[model samples]
Target: MKELQDKISKKLGFGCMRLPVRGEEMEQIDDELFCKMIDTFLAQGFNYFDTAYPYHKECSEAAIKRCLVERYDREQFLLADKMPIWLVKEPSDLNKVFETQLKRCGVTYFDAYLLHAMNKDRIRDAEEKGAFAFFQQMKQEGKIRHFGFSFHDKADVLDQILTNHPEFEFVQLQINYYDWDSEAVEAGKCYETAVKHKIPVIVMEPVKGGTLANLAEEPASFLKELHADVSLASYAVRYAASLENVIVVLSGMSDLEQMEDNISYMREFCPLSEKEKNAIAKAVEELKRFPTIACTKCRYCVDGCPKQILIPELFESYNMTAQFGESPATTRLYRKAIKDRGTAADCIRCGKCEAQCPQHLEIRKLLEQVSEMFG
Candidate 1:
């Protein structure tokens, strides 16, 4: 296995955002499955777990406590948690979140604690809401070993944060071959800025929310033709980890099979060899052939919208409609778009979302089209 640090070995960090569940609700956390996954993970010599305040919507930290922390000694693994500032309104709530996170995890301290989901709006809100001071206070109190944030914003905001908070130990970013130069995501520029800031990187979404897994037929066949044992996903994770200054590559393992596959490959980590690297290098071009709106899944526009429309899924459905021309798949997704939430038709063009969107998408216009198509 590749040693990230002598202090704590890193193979692939376990991201608990989309843990496997039974039916619809996440009340039951698949303990037997998750514990088996963790046991297999540790047996293979991998030990980094990343959980957030609202991962799986208030279930991640507690799941880790049961599936991992409670079962293993503190010294045996490294735990990473985040202070979810987006969930907060008042400044006093910062300490409350931090304290409650510690309590829920049943851990005295965190190896790495980050400000989660830090886009431009969230970062501004954090500073104005006294999160920085509270973060510093936690560091001084010995509650946090290292302080950082997971970001989803433009390069400038990243630069500003790194310049402003040089003391932060690392930055977690959504890095993958597909999003490297994407206008919607720009993973390359993000990674470069982090490198320029001399900040170590922890990569998330290397497989792009399982988007890479369900490739179109041609690419799927191409990948299948390449390797019999490895999956289409292994190439993606290998590509992300091949970058410089990347200390951790996190895959949100949803089940035992996924956990095993990721662990097996990451255990004896090797940089993608010349040919495999070249093949993965062509992923962006291959991905461009697919009909997809350049949505990065950042959800910045949805955050501040008065209408609360799910903009990302709108584009995703549109892309699906455009590509596959499949009525059932696209329409089912479209109907589900507003089944429990707002739709494009409700957009009043308050422009709150436009201001926060790092991609500079003409969200007002997109909403108009979405309303026309799906309303």
Candidate 2:
């Protein structure tokens, strides 16, 4: 574990996916705020940063160039980039995409480069395009120090990938307390698979894209009961970091406050106690009581929505109603959520949103339910 920590500055990695934005437009990143966050992050000795091609509609990489890469020396931090294999139309498209990423980030080489968001479908496409060999060749050429892949598939797929390509030094995974037992995500099973293959794991979504951090009362209360001092977000992050196989826990902190809080807990790392672990397990059960929509609010559904229905916003309101019981304020918020945008009832059942969703949610049915409840 110490060996892994030595490779990077700290266990906490700054994920660039959800950087501070100027307004409703995600592409318009708040550079001043982002720079402060980056400064604090580096000042505190945390170096690792993870970004991908599709984050913030391709602006995230450029934002990193402005807020991070341009400000800091190359040796000051280790940047982890990804190859968007899904974007490749043909084999030659790989070179174009990688070159674009380099130009966007204004960097010659990435410290850690990954095959981004490799699910079964993307993996199949990557194989067809010989992406695995391309990444290896890049590593051989000293373009990428550590060549790995960020995964988003079943244990069997992970197992297959590891079995076939034992050369990958590490694997990035979505591991959190909420999804540990999730049948759909199978976070625990996937972690176990990575451990079985002797691959060091880099954890993403430790806070479940800010879901676990903003817990609905029951789970929050459980953590508070255990240790009132620590932030609720700390437990989620600590759980991921505590695992021996997990080298870095990537937290998508949007502002300075979030960075400060994370750094406070992680600067001097402490693993969760046995009692806290049990409490977390119980808290997971408490969370299961509410049939809340499992949307990570990645907004993959929003970009192409024909009706322009703010799917994540509606789901948040719906989750509030489900977890806290329906209240007048919640209703008012739900109304406001659907005000300017198309209401849940406006969904034409095109299934575009559902098709794009990473969680594979029955979005149409969920939207129908939201309409029924809030109508």
Candidate 3:
């Protein structure tokens, strides 16, 4: 266990969920730019790269193959992947998907493997499907070196999972200052639960899917007054990394510029000072004044929407209007979000989206608000 932990000693991990894309298409990865970003990330001695089955419409694994795995020596980096247990229809589907992920990434073994996006319902599904046993088997066979799960849902659900499955070595959580005490995310409670179980945490959405990075005017200005030059995103990432139990902070950098910006601060990592902590506290309160949708753009709700509503993009448009007030740019963004997809008014209220949402957002009701605002 100590040996494996040594391999992933770095605090910053390259999240492949939002890799640079061509135009607006999710799967259209720009190989040239992606290669440059990876080269720079590794050149700076940051070696961990995380990917999953469903990222980028299922193209992320292959992109990693071409950009990282095939280009760099296997021992040069630590790779992490997740099993989409929800897609496991039967027992055999487990090995089938694992083997496919291996082939997709062109790797014989993964440094870290996780049960993706686990919640209370999915926890039951994992137990009934023998996912835990499968993970043990994979570890023994050298197919996986470390095993855990990425979590969503409440802290109580997290506590239950950790209590029930102490074998899990670590947990990936959605942790950021903005959502730290949020009733919806409950990041603070969840972090404490993981610590209580002695499981180290790997933080995802540390910037709240770029929400904290691009703060609304008041919070942004408040943070700037304290640290005039630092990026707003850096404060959020450092906040997560400051936690003693957290092993790594994953940033879904979409371009070379974003990657460089992250590496600039994280290269010589520093925990937040007393004043910085106080600044973040003030910023969080200021941000809560705006009635913006707390969508992290995870896009989990979009996959099951029967109307094929571009849920996250629409929410982004709504947040812009809510924060900055109505403007031509907001109107254009809303139009672009609805183009070739279901509009907010077209929702059938089938509840599939709400069921799948990690934030437990009242998405149907939120869509109604979006419709009224944009219509």
Predictions: Cα RMSD each:
3.4, 1.9, 0.9
Off by over 4 Å in 2: 1-5, 326-336
Please report, in order, the local distance difference test score of every candidate based on alpha carbons: 0.80, 0.88, 0.92
Candidate 2 residue lDDT tens string, 171-218: 999999999988888899999999899889999999887888877776
Model 2, backbone clash pairs (residues 3+ apart or across chains), number? 0
User: Judged by lDDT, which candidate is best?
Assistant: 3
Backbone clash tally for model 1? Answer: 0
- TM values, all candidates: 0.86, 0.95, 0.98
Q: Which of candidates 2 and 3 is the stronger one according to TM-score?
A: 3
Ten-residue region with minimum lDDT total, candidate 3: 1-10
Model 1 segments more than 4 A misplaced: 1-5, 26-28, 294-317, 327-375
Model 1 quality (TM-score): 0.86
How close to the true structure is residue 337 of candidate 2, measured as C-alpha lDDT?
Answer: 77
